[model samples]
Target chain A: MGETIDLKLHVWRQSGPNAPGRFEDYTHYAKAIPTHASFLEFLDIVNERLILAGIEPIAFDHDCREGICGMCGVVINGRPHGPRKATTTCQLHMRHFRNGEEIWVEPWRAKAFPIVKDLIVDRSAFDRIIQAGGYITARVGSAPDANAILIPKQVAEEAMDAAACIGCGACVAACPNGSASLFVAAKLGHFNSLPQGKPELDRRVLGMVTQHEKEGFGGCSNHYLCEAACPKEISVKWIAKMNRDFIRASLRYAPPVERKEGYG
Target chain B: MASSQVLSFTRTAIGQKALVAVTGIILYGFAFFHALGNLQVFLGREAFNQYAEMLQSMPKLVWATRLVLLVALITHVVLVVRLARRAREAKPAHYRFEERMDPSEGILRRYARQTMLLSGLIILAYIVFHLMHLTVGAVPGLFFVRGMAYENLIYGMRTPWVAGFYLFANLLLGLHLYHGCRALFQTLGLRHPQWDRRSFAMALSITAVIVGTNVIIPIAGLTRLVGGELPEDPQEVLRTGEEKHTVSE
Candidate 1:
């Protein structure tokens, strides 16, 4: 339903963390281009075109090429998914872009986020923080059936939703303060919102938030930007939950006696 | 990273919000009191100027105030930066640019993170420029001259930039107070069933006083790009009705 178009892309290219970075430009010329071509497919065609031209392919990170993976993320001109809600890069189609548009695509910018080549960032920090107690230690013995424990459906649904976080760091990358309260809260909320998670919820939130602070991330100012950018549509309301949990834990929960400060 | 030092920001979404709120309250409290105290300068150039003179005159008090404020300011800033860093570190992928009516929107809306950034920068810039304009103009320690005394504040504020920044400072302070006051109460759980209105009212009043006083002084003193004085004590703000009528009559 639309005419074919050509566009220029300015992408961030870096060899590694300690390496200097520069913007590399590529032009895509295409015909019979379906307006509905997914963003990744558009990139696929561009890469194919480059291959034919004997030019080095533009390097970008993507997996699943589907919205679920959260691997194929780019700001796309100036939006997380080219200005859509609950959509990831793979779901983003090229119909959003017009002909001859100059797109600036860059990786997440933050001191903690060391870039690994093109748009890929070293996001192991997420893993480390997650490992710091984003889960529950309340073991459900096999003797108990799933029905043995009663959980309110609303609470269960909320917990499942919080648990839905795919560990995508889009929240952090989207923040002006580079705050990770949303991700941390989602993880904290995942377990805390459930009955099985009730026992260690305190310890989990305390440990995670503490680890988060020590990692040099800025604190949330409660702007709720993370929710908007999150492909999972994780509500930043979990941040409110996390804040309440941390405060409660500090006052009541936490280890019976404090260990040496920062030991864990 | 001690339990005392760390204080946990990523615990829960609500918990993070609480931290934002609690710290915000602390910061706002300090600013409100500081601004309210600064308004004493308008009570008469001599009394106001003398206040500065007295402050510089006492080493122990000055040092104590500086030490205390430095600790407070540092702690506040560190917590904010640390919280922001943790949030960033926890996310695997970050967003690209998103549209905003203002930079302070979005996550910045949490509790004036953007305003904090802005006020922090503006305050930093103001401090340097202000010190250069005031203290550097003097022999550093002197900070005062018989001619260029605290009385010149109005004249000083007469400049658009100075007045504008002061107004900006007041607005920023208001933003800081708006969320922070409620947060402090929420953090301490001081909201009893009976005093909810009173508590919020107190917080709102304090903010209004600080913002209003700061605003009125600049506008009143520099209304004609010149200096004016208020009689000593807090009740003399109405004496300028002569000039008010001078404009009308």
Candidate 2:
């Protein structure tokens, strides 16, 4: 154990997304805190203190503890996933903070993401958007050889860039407009840019964008904040690509004409 | 799913944005030509009147353009209003003080983002006032003779308040067009990573040309830079009459 750091925290408390929420303050004298302890680890220490004091422990959501799961996200002092760029809340180390520092913590603030509890928001809206058209239609069969597809290096890299989106709701939380354009764009770009996904490109874009709007999320106005807040540092260009595909899909495709009985 | 539902576009945010983008392009074209046409004021009353008369002569063309523009204006206004409302609703809670995470964003970009809706509404009001004063001659004493476009324009702008309003409105238009042009390209799918800066540059340039020329006329009128008094040459007046006759014939 390294030298311990004492700190103060102002955490938001809400029973649900639509429920009334308020900030509650707590003080922790971290007697055995490690300098390299992750932020979540620090929180764990606080939760233990509350449990010993016969107080209800703060509720939050976390999975792998590593940055990959995208399960943990919180607004630390008004920024999504804390002050670090391209870093998740779970990965943020306590060394970034100083002893006796006061931090304001809250869950993601957007109509699309309802708060489930203290510092935990329901991000299931992302799942609905993906369900609309995030996947390419492929027949289940034996895996094909990697060399058979032969994708260009540049194209493969671009696809991978979009595929890096961890489906975190940080983009929505960070956007001034509460828009999910970046997330939606990432999914669209990931599939639409790949050769294997080309056949269903138009349908995917149309379905997803439509579902995005139906989800009651805000529209993007090119603020570029989503790119800045994105843990993966996804490019904002994906948004423009999505917008283009949407317009083209809108005009180029129509349902097949129905035939009258015996008319053909 | 119903085929109609599959083909639907405006039901989505992206679809509404594409609609705004296309209509914006149409309006941009009209604005560019309108500013150019008004630039004829510096060429003297004879030339300016001749230009105005030529436009008025083709009633079919004039009416067609007006009809298209009217439809575009209506569609743009309605869709933008709906989208703005939805965006406002999307954020049920707001920060006590909002700050961008990116330090690189400039003040101008922030201004452009925040004032888009305000500038657009101002432009809409300006358009109505403009039509009343210039097009319909409904502004009693503000606008005089209908056939004398050169005098009407100059004399109408002689009022400092009207001239000031024009200058203010033109400034807002410049801001609106600056953002609109770049977003329009993106909405239309013309964006490429290699050409990212080009969109901003192109948008700024186009805004400069349209807004620069448009403002010059009002400033020229207010400051008496073009000419203090309307052209009074008898021969020039006779040429205008002949030009009008030719246009009508």
Candidate 3:
């Protein structure tokens, strides 16, 4: 058995969307957590103790507990997903924390992401931005052979790197201005790099950027805090690319003119 | 259709950023040329006065350039103000126990990036004071005369308070220029990974040159290193229109 370590957790607790939140001390319940356990498991142990004491368990979101779902996240000591760089909250192990350490956990903070309860926030703002133009209209009926469309190796690698963004909203949470530029840029770059996504590049960038502004996200000031906080390690170069594409599209790409079918 | 498209474009965040970048380029260009022009003060009295005379010689061209610069400054300020406001509104609630991650860009770069608006506004105020003191000659307690650019500059900077203000404002301008130069390229989508480091170095060098020359001019004036001796009787000198002594080469 791994050595157990004591910890003090100050987890954010909010009753509802309109409710004011505060950090609730779980020091007593969080004692003797196993070092081998994940951060989520430590939370589970604390919740179990809370339930036995006839108290409401901390309401937090988690699924798969494997980090790929991008569901589990909390601002542990002011970082989006604890201190481990590029690792999600679920993947953060308790061993990273020292004995008698104090942990402060809070939900993602952004106007677009309202706190639902405790550490869970409504990240639907990201979805709406995605829905604006994050996809291509190209109809690929089935999974075609990879060699059929010969994407250059470098382009494929870059696209894959950009595609690694899991839509976790960490970029927004970590951004000083609460800008979603990195996230939007990642989505645009992922599609724009590939030939299949080239046909609608202008539409995708314009529509998504327009929606991003409408959602009340701040503009990118190139502080690159989002790049630092991103779990996937997406680069800010994509933002530069997005800016380029947006300008090119705005200047030259005109929308199709509407035609009257019967009149005139 | 084109007009509506232009209007709608300006309404978007990227469009606003593009406007800021374009204006920033104009203002930066003006600053660079302005700094080089002001360095003529070190060339002694006659040379500096002749430089000023040449500038006034082309009144129409000078006024047109001024008009363009004024419009660019206004556009830059307004768009950035809107951007900053939206940024504040986007993150309405503050984190009770927030800790910013260490940026990959060094601390100085981070400080410069965060204080762009603050430095920019201060620089704007400095510009007005600068014009009033040196150009319009409306500043109180300064010996003023029409067509006396060289005399006006020396008189203005000889005052300790006025020279201090110029130094402070020029330092902030340096901070503003450092971030503005780097960010403008990024905003305009002109940055490339291959030469990103070179670009940052270029920005620093440009900022240093402008700030160094600007700061030097005032310090030179304060120490009497530049400019001819001030005549004891300003009224007599104004009436006679004669130099008290030739500036040492």
Candidate 4:
């Protein structure tokens, strides 16, 4: 597919969200692209040309050329990066493109994720969810020394598996509902399987879900699309776990009643 | 070490999850019960309407519950916000992300970040409109009537927009619960290799059932697909083996 794909690109051109936003179209000049060139590499060629022409290079989110850092996220032709499995935009190579293709690249379009620039957004809503639904409350010294807790090997591996999320906004960009359950759940699973994260487990789950809802992410439709789009393949299982924790906590919880001490 | 000076590191991937677990459970649990409770409208106006009346009557319980929920909600948001901020802060500039795992990636076991976000957002919108249309009417002394949930339910359904939204949201909820319940089990360390397949299927089916049936109910009412006097038992149709399976994941 390295045929120097002939295509029209509908790129999101917003000076800022408050500023006007428009879709600028450009035709490919047919630069001989390597089939192995990652998608971003292809963009680099375009950016170089724009710079030479004294144009502001297109701004999109990307970091750690490797996929782990979770910096690069964009909707390419309505898909979060070109269609691929367990891969992010940075890892996406050029081979997926055909000789002639009309591609659309846009920043994550969601209410909560307002655009900061061309493709950057104030994705602090994700931060908001983390602040509420994250963490197993532990007093530093209270945690046992590293080896003191012998968690089963499988549990550790699974927890590590959940911990692999890179905080990319692809799920929001790809989700029809713009949900963020996967991101929140991964954080939930990583700590809930261990002893150190137990004391405040109930409180943590309750807090995160509340915050997640406030941020305006859509609900999961059980379509498994988010799992499919996920770069890290973080799993819906953690979310399920989050649900369970909330239920159990609810059953056991007795709302703290603020009394009017002087009179009822 | 002075407790005040101690830098209580608030954000980490592990910590983030603990928060998700707690919050996800509460939200999903509430939704499941709410869906189940709302369907009681078909049990005839008297029974269903009375239920709402009863819940409204307990001001103390309701107040206490709301207070506690507000606090818990605040705490959850605090944790998520801190972690997300740090993650963003750690990256002074935009970075790229890609998936590396292939055949090894478990369907239900991976992709937690995106899924959680999607569900959280959808549920949020649903909650707002839901409370506005359903609960607020009664509390604000708006158009709500005593012992008239059936009439209210039908009237709301008659609006193509409301029915359409309810149907759409329920479907999304189903998709959400499918993996959510299973993920919950895994996070709690309850998954077994031998039964994983069975569990996943079970989880998927439960979400499908809840979302599917709930959507159909609204559509049926709106479209006149199934019309008759109120049924003797509404929740009976929903009785399933999966009720226990819904306990997170």
Measured with DockQ on alpha carbons, how good is candidate 2?
0.43
Error of 4 at A44 (Å): 2.1
Compose the digit string of candidate 4's lDDT tens values, residues B1-249.
Answer: 111221122232333445555676676555556667767766665677688788878989888867766666666556555555543433232212223323455664455434555655676587677677765654242234334556556656656778888887776666566656765555443555678888778766656656766787778777755334534233432243146347544
CA lDDT scores, all candidates in order: 0.66, 0.83, 0.87, 0.65
**Candidate 1, residue A198: CA error in Å?**
1.3
Reference interface contacts recovered per candidate: 0.19, 0.63, 0.63, 0.03
- lDDT, residue B216, model 3: 95
Residue A64 of model 4 has an lDDT of 91
Model 1: lDDT of residue A196: 77
CA lDDT, candidate 2, residue A42: 78
- What does candidate 2's lDDT look like per residue over A25-131, in tens digits? 77653445666888888788878988998878888878988998888888888888888889999999988888777778888888888777777877888998888
Positional deviation of B168 in candidate 4, in angstroms?
A: 19
Residue pairs whose backbone atoms clash in candidate 2: none
For the candidates in turn, chain A alone yields TM-scores of 0.87, 0.93, 0.96, 0.87
True contacts kept of 2: 0.63
lDDT of 4 by residue, A37-72 (tens): 787887777778678878788887777989998888
How close is every model to the real structure, measured as TM-score? 0.68, 0.88, 0.93, 0.53
Worst 10-residue lDDT window for candidate 1 chain B reads B230-239
Model 4 DockQ, alpha carbons vs. true complex: 0.04
Model 2 spans with C-alpha error above 4 angstroms: A1-8, A27-35, A97-102, A139-142, A254-264, B1-7, B140-143, B230-249
RMSD of 4: 13.8
Query: Mind giving the per-residue lDDT tens digits that candidate 3 earns over B1-249?
Result: 121223257888788999999999898888988999989888877788899999999999999999999999999999999999999999987666665776456877888988898999999999999998888889889877777888888877888999999999999999888888888888988899888889889877878889999999889888888864766446666655654444331
